[model samples]
Structures are given as C-alpha cells and as structure tokens.
Target: MTSPQLENHLPFLRKTGGAWELIVDNKPYLILGAELHNSSMSSARHMESVWGKLRAMNINTVLGNVTWEDIERDEGVFDFTELDRVLVAARSSGLRMILLWFGSFKNGSSSYVPGWVKTNTRRFPRAQIRDEHGSLTLSDSISIFHSECVMADIKAFTELQRHLANFDRQRTVLMVQVQNEVGLLGDSRDRSLQAKKQFNSAVPNDLVRFLSSQFNNLQEDAKEKLGRFQDTLSLCHPSDQRSWEDWFGSSVYTDELFMAYHYATYVESIAAAGKRAYDIPLFTNAWLPKPAVGGGLGNLIAAGGALPGSYPSGGPISNVIDIWHWLAPSLDFVAPDIYDADYTATCDTYKRGGRPLFIPEQRRDAHGARRLWEAIGSHLALGACPFGVDSLEPESFAYTAQYKLLGSLETLILRSRQDSKRTFGFYFDEFEGQQADKGPPIGVSFKEFDLLISRAFVFGRPSPGCGMIIEIHVGRYLIIGDGFKVEFKSRSATSTFTGILRAEEKSVQNTVTGALRTERVLNGDETRSGKWVNMPSENPDYGDGFIPLLTPAGTRIVEAQVYSIDE
Candidate 1:
C-alpha cells in the first residue's frame, strides 16, 4: 500500500535508516515535551498560566486536550474558538502542541462525550457488562459495535482535523491523539445485545488473514500470549466460518482479543476519516496494565490490574498491539501511557515493527525523568512526555535539568540517529539506604573494544545519574550527561590491556551548530588514575578531609579516547 501524502511543510513522522524521526521544518526535531493535566487546556486563560512555566522547563511541546464535549457541545454544531485561542497562545510562547481528542472515551469512560450523545442511549448505546452475579448492566463507556456512535465520533474528529488544517497554518499542532485510553473498563468485552450478536458471529476474514500472514512477525509478547490459539491460525482457513471462541480459546484473553479487534477497527474508522480530512500524524495511547498488588477495586484502579477489564480491556496493551498495528492503518503509532510498568520493556514492545517511540504519558518524578535517556538514546525514540506536568512548578520540576541537557544536545542527537546502533543510554536511581541496588553494570560492545558502564564512582553513597554514550569514532566516544563512568576493554584476543588515553570535559559552545569546547582535561584522579573515564556526579563526595580524588560534574559531557596494548 502506498503511504499517504502528508503536507511537506507541516510536522510529520518519517522513517530514516532503521529508526523513525519527527520532521519539522524539513529537519529532524526531537520533542522535549510534557503533558498538561487533563483540564488544564480546556480554558485559554488557565493554559496561559502554565505556558511560560512549560517553556521554563525546556519543554518545546505540550500535550493538551481538545475534548469532544468542548468542541461539539450541541448536535452538528462545532466550536473552535477556545481551541484557536489556546493554539495562538502556545504559538506565541514558541511551543508546539499534540492535541488529545477526548471523544466517546476518556480513561475507558464516556464522560467526555457530548451530553446529547450521553442522553440518547437508544441512538448511541452504552456498552453493557456482565456483572459477577450474571446480571447485564450498562457500562459508562459507549459500545464500539454501534454504528451511530462511531459515526458521531468520526464526524466530530474529522471536523476537528479539518479545522486544524485551515487554522493551524504554521503547523503549530504536530499531531493529534484520536481518543484517550479507549476500551471497556468493567468488562473484558461488551455484553450489549448488538455486541453479543457480533461477538458470536464469524471472525472477520481480514483479521484472520492478517494474523495468519503476520504471525511470524508478531512481537514476542503477542506470540506468547496467543498460546495454543496460535496453532489455530495454521490449521484454519480464512474463509472458514468460525466463532470468536472457536478461533481463539474461551478465556479472558480471548475476550480481550475480541475487544481489541473491534476497538482497533473502531479507531481505524475515526483515524481514517480524520486523515482524509487533513493528512497529518495521528495516534492513540493505552493505559498500561500494572502488576496486581493484592488489593481490591480501589488498588486495581490506581494500579492497573493484570486482567483485561482490570485495565481498559483492550486498549492496545503489548499483547493486542499487533491487532491495532494491522487493523488501524491510519494511526501513525500506538503509544503507552506508562506509569508503574517496566519502562524499558514497554519501550521495546511498542518499538516493534520499526514504529517510532513517542511516549505520550509517564510518571512526572525524578525516577521517571531518568528513563527518558533510555527511551531517546537507546531506543531512538522521537520523544517522551511526562504526565500532568502543569501540576508541578517549573523550578521544582523533575524533568527540567534533563530536558535542558537534552535540548542542548538535540542537534548532535539527531545527527547520530543514523548510527544509533553505536549509542547507549542508561540511568541510576537514588537508593533509600546504604545497600544500593543500581542494577548490574551494563556492557556494550563496539567494533574495536567494549565498555563496562556503571554508576559514577564516588567516595560516598551514590546519587542518581543518567547519561548516554555515542561512539563518534572507532576509538573515540562522546559521553553526555552526569553520574556515570566508563571502563574500556580490548575485544581483540591479542590485546592484553585497554585504558583511556585521554578524556576531556567539553561544553556546548554553539547550541545550533552543536559545537563543543574543551572545558577541562580529565585525567589522573578524574579518570580514576587513567583506569577508567569518570563522569562524576554533580556533587561528588570526598569522604574525608584529604586530597580530593573526584571532581564534581562540569559540562556533564566528556570526550574520551581509548588505547589498547597488544600482548
């Protein structure tokens, strides 16, 4: 299939080499972004209070909401006044936007839908869930099986895109999220009459064909989750009439698969319609499932439960992501709203099939801020945005320092995208007590040698650190950020010893050109007596009143050259 012709002048996603990059003004742009609280963008005046603060935090992009209820309050009526004002305000502040469309569903509920749609249950039916007592009750979410509801969403979303195409002439809005965390909340699959009728019918031939043809290429998590059901794909014919249960086993996972197929198709309709109106990048975000912490409903809601209904039944969690990828052709990608889940694992899963990793939501804390390095440097992510950033002060925001450093190195980072295989990112979180579990030392192999990267060496307790290493040359590396040290070793069998020949602390002399100037010649105590290249913490502990063996972080960047001696 041919790709859609996106407007060249506007911001869009493009695949370069083995990774994806966001192109803005015809250049690779990285999104140093943060998401405002849900209601923060509803009012222009309210957003005014936070735009300057977001800028202060070095956030170039803001993920704000444009709800259905706000845009299409009355039936067939559309209002872009407030949205336009907010867009103008953001542009004035020199910030881009990613508008999240809270249509039909927000956090697995139809609370954001227009009141008319909510009241007219007969026309736009609510999804029904089967309670534990076997009684069917209405869920707060709309049923995806209903065509009227889907049509309404498509119409509203299409109008929104059309308005953006005309109003956002400067391309201030980079992308649009179709819906917020959509899917059934209380049930695995909708139990409404229409939903049940469709559920009991034959599985869609197209979906069957996709699974059959793409089974080998499916993410490992998806393949393993399929279990014995995977065998059915090889045996069953696409034209064969098989019920959902017949094709997949009768379990909660089967219910989830069923919901996923419908949800993806539902989103496909909306996303396709929007793209037809205005061809720009579009995506949806998933409320990721969290580990069960042995608590009840309250805990389950706070920390997403493992089961399907426990977390928005089928909102493109890793296992069902392939269905979304195959079925939702119009969406640029599916993003994960990560909170407590394994951040690296989630990045690896979503980045399958060469999709760009752009985190729409995550924890807004020091711990969460540190993971952005891994997402951008290691995974070659387009960007990552921490959630509810407006709630925190810019002075105290955890992402401020990280974003500042990343923004300074944005030019160099984008230039290295083609050689991402030679780059690595890592982080160490501050431990509560003396016994530090900073994870095992990460080992990275290059063409000439190897590197053992560990927490920055300090005389006292280690502080949190995050950094990335880029192999600018065969034996030379550009180390950025703080609180990390690198130990080089020879990969050749004949070489007996490998050590840092020279290490220089460098500062960004020109942000636009990415020009650097040597700030200090790091050696002796700074490089651990030439044994390793030390990028010490901002405040390195000296332990006792003696000769200071470690220097505090300066420039938070180092250029090191390693040499090996042959036996």
Candidate 2:
C-alpha cells in the first residue's frame, strides 16, 4: 500500500482511535528509544560498532547529527560526505535517524561554523554583545547574517534530505532536526547593529497579514504574534503603529521574533527542497533545559518571537509558542529536548502547541526510562532518547541493554496501548512533586490506569519515611533513576495465572563482544535465604539486555517479592 502523503500523516500523532482510552492509532504505539552521541560521530567508521550495540539494546531510531560546520566547509563549498556516511550506516543498521543540523548555533556556540566563517568577521558578521571587558563579544549567531547561508547551503541541506529519502523511503529516518539546540544567550536580545537597525524600523507586513487571518481580536492576535509583523492590515481602529509594549507585550518581542523567523525560514527551505527529493515526515527538536538557566536568554528570544498560532494545536489549549510551527509548511512537527527537573510540566509546555509531543532527548535514569514509557502512553509522545549512549561507566545504573530495547520499541510504542500492561509511579513531597499533580498526572498510560501520581516516600527511602509505606500495587513498574528502594505488595501476575510457573531470564549483549551479559537481581525474602544472590536462574538471551527472551514471545517470569540491582 502507498504511504500517506507526508503532509497528511503529520497530524496523526495528535489524533486518537480505538476503545480502552486515548489512542493515536487503532492501537497504541508510543516511542521508547535511547540516544547515542559522542559514541557515534559524523563518520562511517564509527557507526558499525556503535550501531551493533544499539541493535542489541533493541533501539530503533537514532537522534543523529549532520553538523553545519561539517556541511559548510568553505565559502560556497559544501560537503555532503560526512552526512552520506552516517546515513548509509544508519540505513544498513536498520536504525531510523533524527538528523540534527549542527548549524549557525549549537548549544550557544559559533564553534560549529566552518574555519572560514569563524576567521572572517567581515563577510559573516556576529551578534554584537557588550561583554564585561567593555569590548563587544560577537555572540548570538542568530542575528549574524552570512556569506555562507546561501542558496547553496539550503540546497545542500535539501539534497542531503533527498539522499536519505532514497534509502529511508520506508520511513526509517523519521525526522530531521533543523538545527542543534537553537537558542539565544546573554542579553535578552541580539546586539547586532544590523539587527538593531531592523528592529527600530517598522514591523514587516507579510507577518501582520498572516496573524490577522489566524487570530481573533486584533489585540489577542497581536499579543500572540508579537514583535515581527510585516505591514499588518490597519483594521483595529486605524493603525497608530502600536507602541513597543503594546506591540509585543514582553521585553523580548523582537529578538524572539527574529530567531523564530530565521529558524522557520531554514526549516521551511529544507522541507520544501526535501519534498522534491522524497516523501516522509520531517521534524525539529528544541533544547529545553529550564526555559531560562539551561538554555540562556535564547529560549525567551526564540519562543517569544514565535507565531505559534500557525501550527496544528491539537489538544487542551493553544497559544503561539515558537517560530517553528509558523514559518515552514514543509516541516512536519516541532519537539523538545527535555532535561532537568519537572518531566510532566516540561512535556505540558510543549503540549500547549497542541502538536504531536516527542522528547528527542532525556536523562538516562532507570526510573526516568520507565517514566518515558508512561510519557509515550500518557502524553502521546512519539519517542524519547537519553544522552551520551556510549561513554556510560560500567557501574552506572543508566547503562544497560534493557534500555536499548526500550529505545528500539519506541517507534511502535504507540501500538502497545491498553493491550500493554499499565504500571505505577512514586515520589515524596507534601504538596509538591507528585503530591500536587493529582489525578492521572500526565506521564504514564494504561487505559483505565489513569495513573495516580503523588509524592510518596521516594522508592529507596527508609522506614520512617511516611511516603515510603505504600508502594505501587502493580506487579510491574519501569525503573529509571538511581538510589531508590521499594518494599511492598503487587498482585502476583504469575501466581494469579495458571500454567505461568516459570522464572525467566535473558542476557542482552554487544554483537562484537558476545561476551556482554545482563544479570537480574534478587530482592526482599524472594531469594529464599541469607543469600542475596541465589535468586531463580533465568537467562533472557542468557543475560543479554533484550526483553523476556530466552525464547520467543516470552512472557514467562517467576514472580518475586522485590527487584533491586546494585549497579
């Protein structure tokens, strides 16, 4: 059967179908994936071994990078070579990829720009910031115009998209990140003399016209679209050219508007060019650290400037959030790179756009990993990824083959809806954390299991902890964080079902080493002795990290009182 047009399928993420509960398809298929970086660079030689490990983990999609510096090597000279190698490796490995454009900005750095651009300030200027030294710092690449951001750059990015589409026609390379962690820093706005000149001038007309049609109440529309309007129609009682505060409401308006507009233009250009190459979904990811401290003033600048009302706001409520949604017709969706505290709240922030929610990056916590699954089920997230896939230490609890499977199954996670088992979560805060987020708490989903999240005693906390007493009553709970303990009861999934008498184990391993092994632990009195080590011997893959697989369709696991691993 022919695939749906890339345009048509983009909205599928927000729509729900089927019986048990909120669904994205006739069945649920939430994403569960891990990210591997610093492990795999923009090189072919590195891909093979790295991917073999990911495959072992059952990880499907990869949030890979096709850096701008690598692509734009010299003035007018573009290289698709590095990008080519990565794509070939990913295709061969059956790994879908999210290509992050390490362009003009990456984690607030001009470091990614080619040597030529960095050296020649004359051709491609910088965002002029007044450093403490009284001298100005050429910061904020967003405001800097370039000799390199040519049709050539756009065309190169476009061609690269087509090249991947040739091999990933089956939809393996699910999305392409327009740029890596695009943000502004230091000053709330750019210090570019050129940017300043433009800001002082009248707002653009095209932008104004666009906002008029999308929003009601000119004032409401003006607030959402703020800062950058290109010749807006003078409807609201003749145009007096609204004042600075009247125009955008916040101090940000201009800078955010510029960043959003710039990003939109790039994404739109790439998307348009790529469609000429092949047809598949394309998405962008944001680096959302703390809306403030983590990403710098850039978050305010970019998000504030956005005409968010332009995109497909799916559920709950809506408002303009970022420039990503408005600028590009070719771009399918915008996502977030979630890190730090407040998983549910952060996800909710993106949900305001009401577009499909996907966490392109996340922490590699065991408890967090499980929460990711819940996130996919609850928030309708397309997938999730953890940072630094390869360098994890041997003792790090985050390092495990079990997670690879979580990553692999991510693409099809939306499929495992009510048919999948729903679990529980725990925490300990009086009227905060889980305690305050009453009701289903917006993270995990199990159809009827509108998960009751509250601040209980943290999992590994001791006896005197009031929140520690009542553990999740479910037999299964996915773990992500480190240093947590749970002592309690769960309906014996095995004991309740007849002919389910078996203790299963499987070891997930590295394809090359074959020597790698996964070991399950014994907890509580379940081990049957002073022996904390002699639990039942089950080798799912003989200690490999993949799921219930000593055999196929494996559901065989002997029930135990508790599970704890001293990683």
Candidate 3:
C-alpha cells in the first residue's frame, strides 16, 4: 500500500509532483523575507529596535548574519549570548529567521574571523593571489588548503547548529546559510606555494570520472568550460596523471574551476559537520558574475577581470556551478546575491538542475521590490530577500505595500504555484522611451481564451508596475499588484469576441480559512467598459494638469471572470 500523504516538517522542501514547496509548521509557507544590514544583528539592542519595524513592513522572515568572530572570540570558547538575545527578539516579534554564518569568508575576505585567528597568520594562512609582475600578495581570505582553518570553521558551525537545535524547539530559525559570498577575491585561484603544488598534481580521479560520465548531462555553462578536455577521462586510463593545465586550457576560467573544487570541498566539509549536529537545511550564496563590461557574447567575464581573482574565484558561478553541485553534496541549494546584474537571467541561472531558487540578497528598492513578484511567480523561488532592509522605514520602504499584500495572500499564492503553468509574475519599469526596446506582452492561456497582459492604460505617461496572476480555473483568474492591465481574447477561431464577465475587488476576510470577501464590483470605468481589467498604479497622474492631484487606483486585488462570444 502507498504511504499516507505527508504533512509539513520543520523547514524542509517538499516536492509536489513537478513543483516544490517549503513546508513550515504543517503548511506550505511562502517567505516574504527581508535581509537585515550585514552588521545590524551584531548587537542585541540594535535588533530590538529593528524587529518592530520589520513586522510593520509585513515581512514574515528576516535573514541576518551570525559572525564566527562574535560567536567564538577566544579560540574554542563559543558564546551564544548575543545570538540568543537576537533569536528571542525575533520570536517575540513574530518573525522567522534564516541565520547566515559569516565565517572564513564574506565577500572573499576573512574579516569576520575571530581575533585569535586573524592575529596568527601562520596557523590560519591567508590566500595569496599573483600580481601582474608574477609576485604573490596576501588577500584577506583564508586559504582553503589549510586544514587548521577548515577544522576551526567546522567546529564553530557545528556548535552553532547544535545550540540552535536545542534552543529553538519552536524552529523559529528556518534555515542556515553556511557562509556569506565565499571565494578568493583578489585572484581567481590562490597562487601560494602550496596551492601551486596542488594545481600541478593530477586532477582527482573521482571528479574526472564524474565529469566524464556526466559530460553530456551537465549544465550548458559547465559543458562549455569542460569542452574537449572532458574526453581525456574517457580516452586515458584512470591512473594517468593530468595536471590542471593539461586537463583544461591554461585560462583564468580554468583557474576558477580549480579553485571551485577546493572551495566546494571546504564548504561541503563544514556543512556536513553542521548537518550531523542539527540536520537543518543549509545553503550558500554567490556574488553573481557582472556582465562583461565591453565583452560581446562569448567574451563575457562575470566579475570584471579576465582572471580568477577578478571575481570571487571558486564561488558557485555558472561556469563551475556543476562542480560545486557534485562536490558539495551537503548543501541543500546554492543561492544568488543579485545586485545590478540582469535580474531574470541571474534567477534563471541559479535555478538550473531543478534546484530551488532562493534570493538571499538583492537590491532593496522599488525596482528590486517589483522583481520579487517575478521571482516567486515565475521562478517558484522559496524566498526573495532584499539586502540592507533595516535601514529603510516601513512607511517609506518600497516593499511595504507589495509585501503586505503578498503576505496576506501567501496561502493562495503557494497553493496556485503547485501547478507551475497556472501562475506567473511580472513587472513593468518606468517607460524608457523606446517602446520597441521593451519585449512582447506577457501571454497566459486558459482552456478557451488567452490573456494578454501589459502596462495599465494611462492617459499620460506610464509608471513602473509589478504584480502576479493565478488562474483559479478556466475563464477565471486572481490578480494582485498594480500598474498593469489584462486583455482577454478567444483562443478558438469560432469565437469572435471575448469580454470580461465580472471583476470583483477581493479582500482576505479570514486568513486561516482562506475566505475572501468581495469589497467592490468593478465594471464600466473600472474595467474600461469590459474591454479589459485594470489594476492601476497606486499613485497615478489624473492626466488633468489643471486639477493637479494624484489619482490612486484605490484597490489592487481583483478576481475576474471572462467569457468568449461564439461567432
């Protein structure tokens, strides 16, 4: 007989057929999460003032850093005094937490390491990067090759997880990020004497075997990097010795791949130790590649320079993401810390190989807030967190209105996402003049009709817009957010016309029961005389310069039913 349908577990990802949902407290939970400023959580008093502000903005979860230096200042002495206070404050404020471990590396630096570790460079050696003159200079990042450094990090992380498991029976802490934006910054790969020796040695037989066997199935980026060298494993004997330069071309990218192996191994070891202690889901975030400054198509360099050190070498970038996935089996998923890059492309890149999309860090502005809808609606992201959220006031923050609405309708959104094709998220930025530059209107299909959604009709110039749509059933849909409109057209040729039958403004009457009540019936001016449904911008110019007053849409949530007229 089949096993019974499972209920929720403590912060685990549950796969439903093809789609995945984060199960928390016996229900599918959507994290309307915000990440605090990097240094905000260092003090208990600072967190005390921020909790109420976060709740006011309707953020259900907050991602904050838990530094290794602060937790274990004097060698083996682990202290949870400050962390305990932060956790208690979060619990009292009714917010879930995802703690980020700032250890060994944060943006490719060992700045967060304990005072003892920093002082003794011999015991915990720093990574050395080569300069143009071929001389090696020390970077702030710890060397992954150092066993002492790895052991120290592993001990501190294991202790933190153990403490969390015992103290948080309520499981207010949902997930733990292993480290913050880890990788060598100055150079792509470490150029220290020890690193050079390792690089010259034969590539690990296990990695070679895995790469050769899975060559065809690898992600596009990884496949491109491995190129013809991948055939070496199949053509040559396993005992054959092939140095890094022999296996792959002597390029900066090759250096990155080499570093990826070591970094993944180091992170995997730490994550594995933590899992053994507490076994909660663990993830690591990446500082995504910036589009090559002037490099066209194939010549693209993600982090400015052509060498490994230019970007955080060895981080989970697209070129070597597969290596990390294969080597770092202990990590639940790899996330992107997206800022300034092409938003949609970065999201798509991280979601490769059926991995869940989770944005741990992103721009915390209107442009960024608007994109969260797309991340959740289109990508099925577990969460999208805006960086440096503590600095913004609730009333002034761009996410305030959007997050509040999503927070209330989260259950419905989560339920709809199970059927991937039925739900979608979108956003329209302020007009950039060239309409042709903007892509085609978004299209959605129901049995007998298709909906074409575009920027809401404006008498004057259009404004920025963002929102999501869910098809409840054929001919009926739920829409949320503002600054957009949807037009329906009959899919069947036999049907000559299509029109909105009814549009009702909806409000969540009871969140527990998922009961919605109609606050207003929209038609005529509201629905543009049944021509289309409008969810206007929260603040719009009245198109009457004479009147000079902002005309608001008044309501953003709507349920619309459409019908096709047979020819």
**Top model by lDDT, which number?**
1
Q: Rate the local accuracy (lDDT) of all candidates.
A: 0.86, 0.47, 0.83
TM-score order of candidates, top first: 1, 3, 2
- Report the alpha-carbon TM-score of model 3 versus the true structure: 0.93
Q: Candidate 1's error at 377, in angstroms?
A: 0.8
Q: Model 2, stretches more than 4 Å misplaced?
A: 1-30, 72-82, 133-135, 140-150, 167-172, 206-246, 289-323, 393-413, 416-567
Q: Over the stretch 438-457, how does candidate 2's per-residue lDDT look in tens digits? A: 32222334321222332222
What residue runs in model 3 are displaced by over 4 Å at the alpha carbon?
Answer: 1-9, 231-239, 294-307, 419-421, 432-440, 544-551
List runs of model 1 lying over 4 Å from the truth. 1-8, 230-236, 294-302, 419-421, 434-436
Per-candidate alpha-carbon RMSD to the true structure: 2.1, 10.8, 3.4
Q: How many residue pairs clash (N, CA or C atoms closer than 3 angstroms) in each of the candidate models, in the order given?
A: 0, 61, 6
Candidate 2 residue-wise lDDT at 236: 47
**Candidate 1 lDDT for residue 508:** 89
Give per-residue CA lDDT, model 1, range 139-162, as digits (tens): 889899879989999999999999
- Against the true structure, what is each candidate's TM-score? 0.96, 0.63, 0.93
Which is the better candidate, 2 or 3, if ranked by lDDT?
3
